[model samples]
Structures are given as C-alpha cells and as structure tokens.
Target: MTTQKIAVLGPGSWGTALSQVLNDNGHEIRLWGHMQAQIDEINNNHTNSHYFKDIVLDEKIEATTDLKEALDGVDAVLFVVPTKVTRLVAKQVAETLDHKVVVMHASKGLEPETHERLSTILEEEIPADLRSEIVVVSGPSHAEETIVRDLTLITAASKDEETAKYVQGLFSNHYFRLYTNKDIIGVETAGALKNIIAVGAGALHGLGYGDNAKAAIIARGLAEITRLGVKMGANPLTYSGLSGVGDLIVTGTSIHSRNWRAGDALGRGEKLEDIEANMGMVIEGISTTKVAYELAQELNVYMPITQAIYSVIYEGKDIKEAILSTMTGQLKTEDEF
Candidate 1:
C-alpha cells in the first residue's frame, strides 16, 4: 500500500477512530479539532478520554487546533465533524487548499436550514474545481466498536465510480471493510433517515417495551423513510442495501448511538435541552428530525414514524403517548407507499 498523508477534521470519537484506522494503515494523519484542550490531550496523552476512554491513539496521528497546519500537505481529507458544522469546516479547508484533493465526509444529516445533505452543503461551501471528488462514508458501524477495530462494514458512495473505489481503498482494512456504491443520494438519505428511527427505537427501550414492539418500529420506520427516499429520487432498492436497513439496525439498537441515547432520555421524561447538555456530543437525529419532517411535508411524502419522532422531540409530546398513537393510529397496507 502506498503511504499517504491524510488530515481528519474533528477529534470526536468518529474522527479520532477513523484517524487511528488510517494511521494503522501506514498513512500519516493530522487529526484536527477546534478545541485546544482536546488536541493537547491527543498529542500529549495519546488518548481522548472524553470520546474514546481507555483507547490509546497512534502517535503518528498528529493532533492540531490549526486547520491550515493540518491541511498543509495532505493528499486527502476526511471531514468527520458534526453535520451542523460540516459546511463551516469545509469552507475553511477549501480556502486553505492549493491543489485538488479527495474530500470525503462521514457526517450524516441534512442541513437544518436548507434541508441539504452534507454532500450538497459541501458543494455549496467548497468550490467545485478545488475538490477532486466529493464522497460520503456511511454504514451501521459505531465509533466505540470501531476504535477497538471490531469487524465493521460500510459503504463509500459518489457519483464517480472510480472516486468511490479510491475512498474504499483508503479505509478498508482486515477489520474495517468498505463497499463502493454509486447511489450517493440513496446512501446519504438512508444514513440520515435511519437516525430518526433509531431515536424511536431508543424511546421504545426507555419506555420499557419489549422485542416485538421494537421490531415493529424498525420495520415500519424503514417503510416510511424509503417512501420519502424514493420521492427524493433515490433508487428504491438501495433501501434494502447496507446503507439503509443495515444502518437502521445498528443505530436503533446500540447504546453508542447518540440519537438513541437522546431518545432514551426523552422516553424517561427528560427535556431536550437537558439531554443535549448531558450528551456533550451533537445528536444528529434531533436536527435531522426537523429537516426530515419539513421535507416530508414539502415533498408530500407519507412519513408517519418520522412525524411521531418529530412530535416527541419538538412538539413536547409524551414519549409513551407518541409511540402509542404512532403504533395505533394508522392501519394501511404494509407496503402502501
């Protein structure tokens, strides 16, 4: 394997973990973050206890607060920041770059204001010619499991097939595997939409519901999101692939999911502000819920599960009441969409 220098923006759990994976693959990585304290911890202690406790980082994975210094000579960059700040960071990177580079983002969510996918936001913020390619990386893998190098499967998607394969090779290792796909719209949509359902799944867990109920939520949630995805011009079959159902299963069930944890807190009758303050990490699903809800309304797509989750999050609806209404309100054909 050819050694490459890569810069990873965001020292969060996901970003840090990915940097470690690339560093282990023999790439020199500059892991950049906004926080000086976090960068200091990573550069000095080789561990970010807040994000990945007890997991030591690769010393080759350099940490920095200066974006220009991190991007100085890197051949590629991974934008692993929160979805909300993805565009902001991309703008900074775009200005700093003097040559074309492979730009891939692992963020999942629509821009709350524009209802734009992360890729779209990247395009809007970064000049087209400066970026050799724009790609998205997504799947069911969690940062907690990934940092330990647990076997994980994910997809690298772009409009350009060759670019997708290049990204696939960048991250794939014995334990971390990536498949290439051309369905960028479907991949991004499925990845973002799954978090809304995962929030609902966490609500079920928090409400003390059992397996039968959770299974029902996952199945029905997929149907609703797929309908919306199809309406948004995604291939219907992509919903059956790894980025769709594969992601929903893991995000909906795992304790590592911030969206699920937020929903769990809501299920236990906590306020949104309280949940956000406690999590420390941004919960993508909460903002994505607002975007998905508005998009469904604007696109005229049927998304009952999304509606229920949105209500529980934004409308201050009781979690138990919201779940009960969502489960009992509609009785259409299973594949009505």
Candidate 2:
C-alpha cells in the first residue's frame, strides 16, 4: 500500500487508538485535538492522558491543535469528533483540505431536531463536489480495548467501493480488522439508532432485569432499526453486519459505553445534569435519542423502546413508569405486525 498522510480530527479514546493503529501500519498520521493539554501531551510526551493513557504514541503519529496543520498534505481525513461538534469541525477542516481528499467520519448520530444522518450533515458542511467522497467507519470495537491491541472488527462504508476498499486497507492491522459494506445509509442509521436501544437495555439492567430481558429487547430493537433503515434507502441485510448487530452488542453490553452508563444513572433516578457532570464523557445516546425520537415521529415509525427511553431522558418522565407503560400497554403474537 502507498504511504498516505492521514489526519484524525478528534483526540478522544477512539480517535487516539485509531490514529495509533494507522501509525502502526506505517501511515503518517496527523492528529488534531481542541485541548491544548492533549496536543501538548501527544507532541511533547507522546501520550494522551485524557484518552489513551499509558499507551506510547508512535513517532509517525503527530499531534496538532491547528486545523490547517492537521489538514495540510493529508490524502484523507477522519472526522472522529463527537456528534454534536461534527458539523463545526467538518466545516473548519473543509476550508483547508481540497475536495479531492477522502473525508471519513467515525462519529455516529443523527442531527437532533433536523434528524439528518451524520453523512448528510458532513455533506452539507463540505462542498457538493466532495459529497460522494464521504465515508463512515463504524462497528463494535471499543476504544479502550482497541488501545490494548485486542482483536477488533469494524466496517468501512462509502458511495464508492474503491473508496471503501481504500479505507479498509488504511485501517486494517494485526489486531484491527476492517470489512467493506456498500450500504452506507443502513450502516450509518443502525450505528446511530442502536445507541438509543442500548440506553434502554442499560436502564433495564439497572432496574434489576436479567439477561433474558436484555436479549429480547436487543432482538426487537434491531427489528425497529431494520424497519426504519430500509424505509430510508438502506438495505435490510446491512443491519445484520458489523455496523449493525455487532455495534449494538458491544454498546449495549459493555460498561465502557457512555450511553449505557448514562442510562443506568438515569434509571437509578439521577438527573441528566448531574450524570453528565460526573461522567465527563460524551453520552452520544442522549443526542441520538433526540434525533431518533424526532425521526420516529416524522416517519411514523413505531419505536417503542426509543420512545420510552426518550421520554425518560428528555420528557422528564419516570423511568419505572415508562417501562411499565411499554410492558403493560399491549400483547400480541411474537411475529405479528
């Protein structure tokens, strides 16, 4: 493979680990972070204390706070910032990189209120000529596990098969595996929407439910995802791939998931303000819940789990009440519509 200059625009755990993986594979990586402390640590100390602590960064992995420095001379860019800041960061970076650079984003969430997917948001912020070059990297891998070089898998989806293959080659390593998927819409949607269901699963676990309930919810929750995804131009089978069921399993079951942890706190009767303050990490499920609820409303899609979680989080409803309301509302055959 040709050596390429790769720029990653986030300094969080996932971003740092992914940058490290690319650096390990002999690619030149330019990592961008908003915090001076993170930039200083990466450049001066070869470490990111705030994210991947104790993991020594490769010399090929250069860190920068300046957007231009990160974008300059980069053949491709990874937009790994949080969902809320995706558009803002994309707009700033677009100003420096030309339209030919392949822009890939790992952030997974629909735009709240607008209900637009992250790819749509990226396209809106960047020039129209570069829209088709956008790519999304998603799957079940957690950043913490990835930093340790554990075996991991993810999907690279793009409008062009060649672009997807290129990103796959760039990211695949000894412990990191990449699969190519052409259904970008379904992959992105499943990746975003699964977080909402994960919140529900965590809330159920917090309420003392066992594995049986969690398994049932995950199954039904995926049905909801598949229904909406197909309606939005995604292939139904894509949701069965790494970006779909794979992501849902990890996010819903792992304690490392910010959304699941946040939902657990909420289930225990904690306020959003207090929970967020204590966690200090982006609970993407919060933002995704807003977008998922809005999309459900606009599309008239029946997302009971998403609706229940949204009620508890944004509508000030009691978690127990929401759970009961869903459970006791109706009963039907297992496969009945």
Best by lDDT: 1
For 1-337, candidate 2 gives per-residue lDDT tens digits of: 8889988999888899999889888899999988888788888888877666578877667888889888887888898888888888878866776656888999888877678888888888888665446789999989989988999999999888999999999999889999998888998999999998888888888888889989988898898888788878999889888999999999998898988888777877788999999987888888888887888788888778888988988899989999888788778666543
Please give the lDDT score at residue 182 for candidate 2.
85
lDDT of 1 by residue, 273-310 (tens): 98999999988899999999999999999898899888
Task: Estimate TM-scores for all models.
Answer: 0.98, 0.96
TM-score, model 1 to reference: 0.98
**Where is model 1 more than 4 Å wrong at Cα?**
none
The regions of model 2 sitting more than 4 angstroms off are: 128-132
Clashing pairs in 2: none
The weakest ten consecutive residues by lDDT in model 2 span 328-337
